[model samples]
Target: MNHFASIARVPGDPILSLMEAYRADSHPGKLDLGVGVYKDAQGLTAIPKAVKLAEQRLLDSETTKSYIGGHGDPLFGQLLTELVLGADSQALAEQRVGATQTPGGTGALRLAADFIRHHLPTRGIWLSDPTWPIHESIFAEAGLQVGHYPYVGADNRLNVEAMLAALNQIPQGDVVLLHACCHNPTGFDLSHVDWLQVLEVVKARELLPLIDFAYQGFGEGLEQDAWAPRLFAEALPELLITSSCSKNFGLYRERTGALLVCARDTEKLLDIRSQLAFLARNLWSTPPAHGAAVVATILADPELKMLWSDELSNMRLRVASLRDGLVTALEPHGLAQRFAHISQQRGMFSYTGLSPLQVKRLREEFSIYMVGSGRANVAGIDAERFAQLAQAIAHVCVE
Candidate 1:
C-alpha cells in the first residue's frame, strides 16, 4: 500500500459549489442569487470604466520589471491609504498608520490574523455569530482561538443589546472582528449610533478591533461608507483595517487590497509594519502589481476617480431598487409582510428569512438558487427576473 493514502477529501465551498450546480442546470429560467460576487442588470461582472482607462494608461508606460519591496509598490500603498483613510486623515498625518498591499481582502484578513497571533498571542478573536464564514476559519487556521458575539436577532436586525453584552464579556487584548460596512450573508449592519456604542465598549475593554471593509462603495457613497472605519481609527488608540477593491473596483480576479495598522505611537507603528513585511516575505514573497497599479492610477486622477464614484453610486441605487421590486412583487402572494426585512437590509445581500426547506423548494421547483441559509445576492436579480423570483420565493415560503 502507498504511504500517502491518509489524505482525506475536503468538502467543496458552499457558495462556489452552488454556483457550479446553477451552471449545470439546463432550466431556461434558472436564477443564481447564491454567490457573493456582484452582477449588473445584464448579469455580467464587467471591469469598472475607471479600471479600463487606467489599464490603457499603464500600457503606455515603460517601467522596469524589477521586484517591488516586500510591502509591494510604495506608490500603490500610499494611494490605497489615502483612498481608504481620506486625504486629511489624522492617522496618516501623525505617522501612526502603516499599510501593506495584499492579494485581496482575504489576503488582508489572513495577514491581520498572523499579526494578531504574533503581537497578542494570548488573546483569542471574537467574530459576529453570522459573519462571513471565512473569518472564523482564517483566524482558526492562524493558530488563534475564535469565539462568537451575537449579531443578528430573530427579527432580522442587529441585536444591539445582545452584541453589547457579548462585547462586555470579551477579555482585554482580544481581537474583535467587525464588518465595517455592508455585513455579509445577513446584510444587517450597525447604525451610526450603534457604532459609537460598540466603539465605547472596545475602548473600555482595551480590545483590538479589526475592521473588514470589502463593500465600501456598495452601500453608500465612498466617503460616507468610510465613516465607520475613519471614526474608529480616530477614536481608538489601536486599530487594524482590511480594505478591498475587489467589489467596488471590480478587481476580484486581480486581487487588490491593503492592510492598515493604526497605533498611537509612531515607533510601535514602524515595528508592526516591519513584522507585516517579514510575514509577507514568507507568505507570497511580494504582492501582485497589476491590480494595485490600476487602482492607484484611477485614484490619482481626479476625473477618473469622480467617474468611478458615480458608477459605484449607480450600482448601489440599482441594488436598492431591486430589493424594493422584490417586495412589491411578493405583495399579492402575501409574502411582503414576511420579506419586508429584505428591503430594510443594506449592501448586496439579504437574508430572505426562508427556511432551508423553502430554499430547497425554490431550487427544485423554480430553478431559483439561493444559499440554503436563505441569503440572496440582491445585485444578482434584475428587472426581467424580479417578478419571477418574487413569485418563486413566495410560493415556496407559503405556510
Candidate 2:
C-alpha cells in the first residue's frame, strides 16, 4: 500500500446516492423525488426555449474566446444585479453594489466562505439546524467554526421564536447564512413580518447576513420571489448575496451563478471585490464564459427574457400544484392532518415529517426515492403519480 493511504473511505452523498439507487431500480414505475434539480412532467431536464434562442444569438455573434477578467464580465454582473435587485435599486444606482460571476451557486458560497474566513476568522458561521447538508460541509472545509440556528418548528413551520433566540445568542461579527427564499430540504420560509424581525436582530447584534438564493423564479414570479433579498439589501447596510441560474434558467450543467457584495461605502466595496478576485484567481482562475454569455444574451433580449419568465412561472405553478395534489391524495387515507404542511410549504421541496425508517421503506418497498431526511423534491412529481406517491407515503407513515 502507498504511504498516503491513511484517508478513510467516506460515504457518497445521500441525495446522489438516492439518484444512483433510482437509476438502478428495475421497476418501470419507480419514481425519483431526490436531488434539488428541476424535472418536467416527462421527468426530463431539457434546455428551455429562451436558452436555445440565446445560444443561437451567441453562435451568430462574432466574439473573441479570450479569458474573462478577474471579476468576469461587468455587463453580466450588472444584468444579474438588475434582474435580482430590480432596475431602480438605490443600492445599484448609488454604486454600493459589486458582483462577480461564479461557476455556480456552490462557487459563490465557497467564495463567500473564503471571504468571511479572511475578514472575520474568529466569528462562527450560523446555518439552519436542518439546512442543505452541503452548507455545513462547505463552511467546515473553509476552516471556520459552524453553528446551527433553529429554523423549522415541530409543527413543520418556521420557528420564528427559536430562530430569534438563536440569533440573540450570536456574538457580534458572526456570519448568519439565510436561504433568501425556498428553504431547502424543508420548504418552510420566513414570512415578510418574520423577515423584518430577523433584520432587527441582525442590526442589533451586528451580525453579517449571507443570503443564498438558488431558486429565484422557482418560487413565486421573478419579482415576487426577489422580495426577500431586495428587502435585505435595502434594510441592511452590508450584505452578501449568492444566486444561481441553474434551476430557474435551466442552466444546471452550464454552472452559471453570481456573488454580490453590498456595502455602505465604495472603498469597502473595492476591498471586497479585490479580495474576491484574489480568491477566484487561486481557485478556478476564471469561470466558464459560455453559460454567462448565454444568460447575458437572454437577459438583454426583451422577448427572450419574457419567454424565460413565463417558462419559469409554469415550473413554479407545477410544483405548487403537486403540493396541493399530495395533500388531497392523503386526505382519504386519514393522514391529511399530518401532511397538511406539505401544501403550505413552497418551492421545490417539503419536509414530509417522515422518520428515517419510513424513508427507507419508501425507497426499498415502493421504489420511491427521497432524501433520507424525509425531504421530497416536489418538482419531481407529475400529476399522474401524485396519487401513487401519496398512497405510498400514507402507508409508510401510518404503519
lDDT of 2: 0.88
lDDT of each residue in 1-399, candidate 2, tens digit only: 798789898999878878888888999878888888788888888789999989998889947999988788777898999998999998888888998899999999999999899888798999998899999899999999999999986666678899999999998879999998889979988888998999999999999999999989877778987888899888888999998989899999999899999998788899889999999999899998888888888898899999998888998998998889889988888888888888888899999988789989998899988887889998888679778888888788775
Q: What lDDT would each prediction earn against the true structure?
A: 0.89, 0.88
After superposition, candidate 1 runs with Cα above 4 Å error: none
Q: For residues 1-399, write the lDDT of model 1, one tens digit per residue.
A: 888799899999999999999999999999888988888888998788888999999989938766777887788888888778898999889989888999999999999999888878898999997989898789999999999999996666679999999999999878899998889879888889999999999988999999999999887678888889999988977899998999999999999998999998899998989999999888988999889888888888999989898888998999999999999998988888878888888899998888889999999999989999888999889788777888887777767
* lDDT of model 2, residue 58: 83
Per-model TM-score, in order, reads 0.98, 0.97
Question: Residue pairs in steric clash, candidate 1?
Answer: none
For candidate 2, the 10 contiguous residues with the lowest summed lDDT are 151-160
